[model samples]
Target: MAGQWVEVLGGIMEGSGQILRVSTALNCLLGLLLWVQKIRAGAARHA
Candidate 1:
């Protein structure tokens, strides 16, 4: 999977920081790295 990337929606609706933290840990354990976007977007929308 060289030069490949996976997209994940990171927002309050998706379990917020908890999901982000767990996903990152799992990626690390699987020897893969990922990039996240729109962190806390839902919270921002509500605000």
Candidate 2:
């Protein structure tokens, strides 16, 4: 029973870690997209 509990906890920890990594990646992607848009807008204004 203890072993089963340990396994369950381990799985939950791994799942949470994976979710955190994905969220961080998505945030970085969004930031990059925003930065690109801002640059393009600035260029357009100068032109």
lDDT of 2 at 39: 19
Which residue segments of model 1 deviate by more than 4 Å? 1-4, 44-47
In terms of lDDT, the poorest run of 10 residues in model 2 is 1-10
TM-score for model 2?
A: 0.34
Residue 5 displacement in candidate 1 (angstroms) = 2.8
- TM-score each candidate: 0.55, 0.34
Model 1 TM-score is 0.55
Error of 2 at 38 (Å): 34
- List candidate 2 stretches off by more than 4 Å: 1-14, 32-47
RMSD values, in order shown: 3.2, 18.3
The C-alpha local distance difference test score for the whole of candidate 2 amounts to 0.33
User: Residues 1-47, candidate 1, lDDT per residue (tens digit)?
Assistant: 53356666776467577768876776766655567777677764543
- Report lDDT per candidate: 0.67, 0.33
lDDT by residue (tens digit), candidate 2, 1-47: 11121111222323445544554555565432211112122222343
